[model samples]
Target: MSGGKAITCPACGGKIEVRAAGFTVNLACQNCGSLLDVSLPEVVLIRRYKNAKDRFALEIGKRGTVFGQEWEVVGALRRKDQITIWQEFLLFNPYLGYRWLLVADGEWQFGTPLADRPQGDRNRVFWRGENFSRLGRDQPTSTTAVAGEFYWRVKAGDTANATLFQSGETILSREVSDGEENWTQLVPVDETEIENAFGLNRRSLPRRKAAQGLMQFKAAPGMEQDDLGRMFLLAMAISLFAAIAMALLAGPSTKTSSMIQVPVGGQIAPVKIGTITVRRPWQFVTIDADANRFENRWVDLEYNLVDRSSEQSIDAFGLVEHYAGTSSDGAWTEGSHHGDTMFGHVPRGTYDVYVSGSAHGWPVDPAVTDAWGSTETINLTIEASTGAMSWGMWWTLVFALFAWPVSILWWRFRDK
Candidate 1:
């Protein structure tokens, strides 16, 4: 102020001043509606503009050091859409030139003018090997208010075709008017950062809406989102690979399938099954015995497997029912005649299995089945098998693990 040229307002005859006035070109008269030209040694009049509709939070002429550089809050221009209005404060640093901070509903965006406009393919803006999404179609944004000194002559009633794009937390904005296109890179700033930058000692600031918070600030997803996405992908990959490996391990090398017939009320002689030669590489041995009766009846098979060398008998009791009936709800079917079980760490020894079955849910009157001319005794054919391993539970866990990341990405994009 001391080294600057002292001049009186051309319209009010009041003192017109510029602080740290190095390259200041235009100054607004506070006492009168006059835009003063301060480029020359003697200040002159430009044109008068209207006062702002709302008072500003950051006072004009207040100096603050940001990013190791001191800046003065010089000019401010308020812009409005149909129903929403926000202020853009222009900050000037001697060496850094001019930047702007747009504040809307306590959300802030600090932007710097770009000398070159970004390239866009179709509607997507591309910069720094990243893609940006557009906020809306380009439209006119009108300037509603003007105040303080600026490097350029700006006034109310001027309009610019503006468009905003988002890339992570950064926003790319373009404004064009009268063949002049201005591009800026806007970086989101929260209330804490804004308060610290302006040295405000307030305890709390206004809260942003949940909807608006998505677009108002934090224009891009931070590292946490990217890290989560990568983690989910890793989980899917690892689980998929593990599942395939387990499927191969659990696949049976030799299927020793045999059959035996048992009377409905009687038992069948124990039949010898080949010993499992699979060693520790296979986690466990799975045994499957499917008992089938030609009639529509349930066969409850009391079964047991014995290691012939150790003489340790393992109970393998199971049920096989063939039920198909038409109900009011729909056609219903339940219970397959296939029962499977698994044994952990079965040693390499000859195995023998015995099965005794009883046919239940049979008509007390044989007359009912005799009318259909069926036999009195139903034969139960038992088919036995063994696998190298059992990984049904493990497969379920792996599939669930793979789904976690997919669900996260689903919701993330859905909301975004």
Candidate 2:
């Protein structure tokens, strides 16, 4: 049952039902479409909507149960933005206050006015610990039509600025004017639920026509979605073939190894390894070092590759160590006995390799002695190789190929 009051429209002498009673401030004459102020004891004319043709799915005073709550449709407004037009139905329950049902693009959403402001700047906001990104700049919106009863003095051609932020299915909308600001939280409502609740015929419901111009994309003449898909596949195939060919052409590798002995607490002179010849214009050189069965000792090695022609040195470094001891958790071992380093973009050249290193014992073991009495020494082997290609370059090529098609898709459907 509607807890409403019936009044006479002073402009057209039509009987109007004020559904919200004490809360309703303005109402439209259903017969003459004259705006009337209902807040005062006597109704006063505000404006006349010339040639008004009301086309609404739910009439004023219609009762519906939504979200398990009984609500009456008290008012309705047809609003428009720069791109499209939609309708908003004002719902009222004596105990639950006011809510909104927004219809756009043949879809529906239930809106609840937010009491607390969301946290963030205009570009982004956080609500309930979730982040929302702003959809676009503020849009200018105008009320083009009004019907039934409303709490505020609503009239046609009323304007405001609206901004929207969205995270997944939830949307936050802010509408501001010089005098007032309002925020609403909106969530999608199923069409079936709405139809059952309002006794609506889905086939008779009015749907806004699809928007045109730049909002939608069309394929170029003689090109279809299938053609674009084939082109994308061909581009990927070409990149794949090029990557495989580069990998197969890395050629054979040249290896050179040498062993060196370092006295504890002292440095060893640089040792010369065999020369490396690069057959490719550019390649990567790898150095490997191993110190075996050495406990609590570390050796640091520096490598220098001097080109035979220009004497330009390309330098690199490596470290190898092995330590074992007993702790609260039984025996524990740390550090590696072997390490490797790689140098890239070494231009074509015949280079002579030199290796120098230093050795140190952990905790400064003073009583330690080796076969060379009173002098503890650790022996380590160093190896160098040439002509290997980098995996980094291969992955980079693959990324570029896939990114091209993705960028094209984004450009075409950005507005949609």
lDDT measured at residue 28 in model 1 versus the true structure, 0 to 100: 72
lDDT of each: 0.64, 0.81
Q: Once superposed on the true structure, which residue ranges of model 1 sit more than 4 Å away at CA?
A: 1-164, 167-255, 262-283, 291-296, 362-381
Across 1-416, the per-residue lDDT of candidate 1 in tens digits comes to 12344568877687756754767777776656578888887777887534433345676767776655667787777777533577887887766778987877767888899886689853688877778887644556898667777877677778887877887788898888889888899988676666666755232222232444223222233454666667677877877778687667554544455565544444445555444444334345555656544445566666566767778876766666676767899887777767666666554555666556665554331343456754444544454445444467667877677665555455445523
Q: Which of the numbered candidates is closest to the native, going by highest TM-score?
A: 2
TM-score of candidate 2 relative to the true fold: 0.51
In candidate 2, what are the lDDT values of residues 298-320, reduced to their tens digit?
88889999999999999998888
Model 2, residue 343: displacement in angstroms? Answer: 60
| Model 2: CA > 4 A from native | 50-52, 201-206, 209-416
Error of 1 at 100 (Å): 13
Model 2: lDDT to the true structure: 0.81
